[model samples]
Target: MGQLFESVVMAVKAIFQNKTRAFLTMLGIIIGILSVSLMGTAISGIDQVFEKSIESMGQDVLYVEKFPWFMMNDDWWEYRNRPNIEEEYAQQILDRSSTIAFASPSSSRRADVKYGTQAVEAVEINGTTWQEAFITSVKLESGRFFSELEDRYGTRVAVIGYDIKKNLFPDEDPLGNYIMINGNKFRVIGVIAEQGKFLGLMSMDNIVTVPLKAMKSVFGRLRRISISVRPKEGYTVDQAKEELTFIMRGLRKLKPREADNFAINQQEAFRQQFSNIRFAISAVGLGITALSLIVGGIGIMNIMFVSVRERTKEIGIRKAVGAKKSIILFQFLSEAIIISLIGGIIGILITVALVGVVQKFFVAQLSFSLVLISLSVAVLTGIISGIVPANQAARLNPIDAIRYE
Candidate 1:
């Protein structure tokens, strides 16, 4: 312990002797740490956003659609030719499938909405049954979702999204107010809660929903629709999917040898797709980090060699005065570590400051684990880069080194 302390003191003195050189040597480490840490922060932010978006999407729900969310074979044209998912399949799934607890058929179209003089354009108008409220995780900010009776009656009542409420009824209570959609007067019954953005690209809250009956008349029954399905409380997604598939195949009247022309989409499939995205981002980050750290490590190694040469006479003098070879090695190693660690600390501080600005635009998170990772990498780089130069310094003969000057 005492020897290590003395070595650290020696290292500090040597660093101060040429402060500019020490700082310059630390530059590589600083940049390396900064690049890697920022990459981690960006990845973490993406993960956070993904998790939140997934939660809003409901973890257990399934979508019966004409096309899969991810086409494994890149055969999109094959799937495009498949028939549209019928809206009535939602009821069939609920009635025939033991695994299904709730099902809601929904369709969407972009249209303009107006409340008196205020207007919002390109708003998504959703048409679904009352059961949709049970399958989705979206919460109502005010009033309540339309009831089964309202859906049966094809009432003109609509539930507006948070953004629409803000845009069209900025000063007044949106409830009980009438909004014009496709030149049709619809009364606002509820406001969907704010759901932020979906995948950070589109706003989930920019929507208006009405009953499927009304939706057919407003958007036309000619358009195809998808059905949302939720599994029974204790049923696995696979079990639910199997039941759904069986019913859909039967409903489509597919012959024993004929392939069914439908897609069953679930959160798990979405997760797999997102995992691929994460892997892609990680690969890029790893490449950048590897390059930066390697350059930084090389820089440190070169500087340590120069340092060993400059301190040879001093090493010999200390050895002559009873300094062990281990002490000399420790001294150089500690110096490298300190420089690298200081650089890492500076990088972390920089990351912390930038995290706030990043969140304002998108999402960036600086976590404690990420800091630990940066520091560990910095320290590891120091140790690896310093070892050979430190060993060379330790192996020098006192008589030869003293005579070198």
Candidate 2:
């Protein structure tokens, strides 16, 4: 161990002696490691954000929809095949499912909201129940959410998003303020808590929700509705799913073996889908990183060969003085490893710093696993690249080498 440490120290000193040459030699490795680490960090951060978003949606609640969120095929063929998920069907499921706490059918429409001279355009107007705001974590920052009694009375009250509140009512309280949906007057009842932005594009805060009855009154017909249902506490998720499926199947009046019309989307499904995508991304990144390492290895091998040729007389003299072949081999190999490792360390630091800067601005998070993996790959590359040169140095003919010099 002591001998190995001494050899490593010597290798490091050699690296610093010709710093520019060493750095140039390690260019490929540095870029490769940096690319991989940065990609890994970004991927990890995105995965974390997705996970947090799903978790915030509540594990007990299932997001039932006709089409999966990440499905690639959104064309006519897929859409036609998908069963129509209507409000009536959602209600039937709610009535039949014994394991469910509350099931609410929701639908959205994007339209311009007018508040006297002020106007907010293309805002998502979500039509859902009072239970939706409570069960699906739609917290209010101020004012009051519409009650079940108000919903039953078909009240034209609106709950604005945090951004909407800021846009429409900057100076004053928005509650009980009258607003128009393309001309029809509605009262502002509540404002939602700030949910920031998703993917730096869509702001969750830039939405407004109204009761289902009010929406039907204003919009004049809703064919589809998303059902959000929470399983009762103390029940396993699978058990809840089974019960809900059974209830849905019964409500749809399908045969025991027949496929049901409604779909049950859960938090775990999103987790699995997102996790699979991330894994695929990581795999592609690893493959590319491997290719870069291979190229860098070739460069190392070429440089080591040149080094060995330049030091042929030294090798011969050392061998004449009883320096073993193993020691020579170890020295060359250690040099290669040192060069790659220095590059790797620098790459890891740069990537980590970049990730830190990104995390400061974004809600996502990057982790240390990226650095660990990149460093490991670099070390492995060094070992692989050094092997041939080390072996050649070890097997040098001392008499012939001395005669040539």
Candidate 3:
């Protein structure tokens, strides 16, 4: 321990003697560490964004649609030719399935929404039954969801999202007020809680939902509809999916050898797709980071060699004074390690600052694990890059080194 401390002090003195050169030598390491930290922060932010988006869909809900959510290489025409999933399937599933706790049919389109003089364009308008309140995890911020009777009678009662409420009724209570959609006036019965954005791509809170029958009456039955189903409290997601598939296949009258025309999608589909994309991003990012680190390691090795050459006479003097080769090796190695560690610390500080700025717009998280990993990489790089040069310095013949011109 005493020897190690002495070597560290010598390394520090050596670094202080050539501060500018040491900083220049560490430049490569700094850049490499910075790149890796930023990459990790971005990946973590994307994961957080994805998790938030997926939460809006609910973990237990299953979506039954005409087309699969994930289509890999399969011709679009194959899905295009498949039969459209009808809204009636929601009722059918509810009637036949014992595992399902709730089911609702949903359809959406973009239209201008108006309340008196205030208007918002291209707002998402959803058509769904009252059961949507149960199928989805969306909570009401104010007022109440439309009743079953309202849905059955095709009442023009509408439930608005947070953004819609903010834009249309920024100053007044939205409940009991009428909003215009496609030239038809509909009474607002409820306001959905703030849902934020979906994967930072689209606003989930800029929507208005009404009864399916009311939507068909106003917009016609031309738009495609999907069925959302949720399992009962005791049932598992897989069991629910199995039962739903059986019921859907029976409804479509598919033969034993024929594939079902409809697709059953769930949160796992999105999770799996996100995982694949995250894996690809991480793989590519790691490759680039590895290249940078390798370059940095090479730079360290080159600089260490130069350092050894310059200090050959000093090494000979220490050897002549009876210094052990191991001490000489440890001194050079400590210098290299200290330089890398300094670079790593600077990189971490920069990353933290960058993450702070990014968090205002995105969701970057600078985790402790990432910090530990980065510092460990920097230390390991130092040890590996310093080995050959340190050995060369240690093995130098005292007479030749002292006499070196």
Candidate 4:
């Protein structure tokens, strides 16, 4: 332990004697560690944002549509030609399936909404059944969701989103107030709780919802619709999906050999797609980071070689005084490791500061695992870079190195 401590002290002294060269040697390592840590933070932030967006869509809900969310076999035309899913299927599923707790058909269109003089343009207007409240995790900030009777009788009651309420009814309570959608007058019955951005791109709070019947009356029923279904409390998702598929196949009247035309999608589908994207991003990011680390390692190796050459006479004198080769090797190797560790610490500090700045635009997280990973990479790089130079120094002949002018 004492010998190791002495070697470390010698390494520090050597490094301090040539502070400028040591700093230059550490520069590459600093940049490499910074790049890797920042990349990790960005990926973690993206994942968190995606998870929040997915949570808005209930985990237990399944979406039944004419086309699948992900392309299968590059067959775009095949899905495009599929028949449009209709609102009637939602009722059929509810009536026929025992495993389904709730089912609702939903469709969307972009339109301008107005209350008196205040107007919000290009707002998403969703047409869905009252059961949609059960199928999704929609919470109300104020007022109440539309009743089943209103949905059945095609009442002109509407539920507004957070942004709509903010823009249209800045001061006054939105409940009991009539809003104009396109040209028709609809009473606002509820206001959805604030839901931030979806995938950090589109605002989830900029939407308005009304009864399916009312939407069809206003916008026509030719547009495609999707059914949202939730499994009963006692049943699993797979069981619900199985029951739903059987009923759908029966409703569509597919023959024994004929394939079903509809698609059943779940929250996992979105998670899988996001996971693939994240994996790709990680691969590319790590690849680039590896390149930077490689360059940094090469720099360290080159500098170590120059250091060994300059200290040849010093090494010879130490050997003549009976200094072991292992001690000499440890001394140089310790210097390299210490330099890398310093760079790693600086890089981590910079990353923490940058993460705070990045959080203003998007969520960026830095965890202890990332800190350990950066430091480990630095240590490994130092060891690998110092091996050849340390070996050369240890193997130098005492007489020849002492005589070197």
The sequence of per-residue lDDT tens digits that candidate 1 reaches over residues 96-201 is 8889999999888889998898889999999999999999898999988999999999898999999999999889999998999988999999999999998776
**What TM-score does each of the candidates earn?**
0.94, 0.86, 0.94, 0.91
**Cα RMSD for candidates in order:** 2.0, 3.2, 2.0, 2.4
How much lDDT does each candidate structure score? Answer: 0.89, 0.79, 0.89, 0.90
lDDT of 2 by residue, 1-405 (tens): 676676677667767877888888898788789778877776867766676576557667876677656556645465558667777665677677777777888899899988878999999989888778656766789988889888878799999999888998999899989988857788998998887666434678878888888988989887567888877777777877888777766766799787655568887777788778788888887787777778888888888887778778877876787768888788889899888988899888777677778777765444666667788889888889988987787789999766655
Question: Which residue pairs overlap in candidate 3's backbone?
Answer: none
Runs off by more than 4 Å, candidate 4: 1-28, 321-323
Q: What's the true lDDT of residue 318 in model 2? A: 69
Identify the superior model by lDDT, candidate 1 or candidate 4: 4
For residue 179, give model 4's deviation from the true position in Å.
1.8
**Which sections of candidate 1 miss by over 4 Å?**
1-3
Per-residue C-alpha lDDT of model 3 across residues 264-380, encoded as one tens digit per residue: 999898889999988887887788778877887888889889999999999999899987999999999988888888888888899999899988877788888999888988898
Ranking by lDDT: 4, 3, 1, 2
Global CA lDDT computed for model 1: 0.89
Where does candidate 2 clash, by residue pair?
none
Model 4 C-alpha lDDT versus the unseen true structure: 0.90
Highest lDDT model number = 4
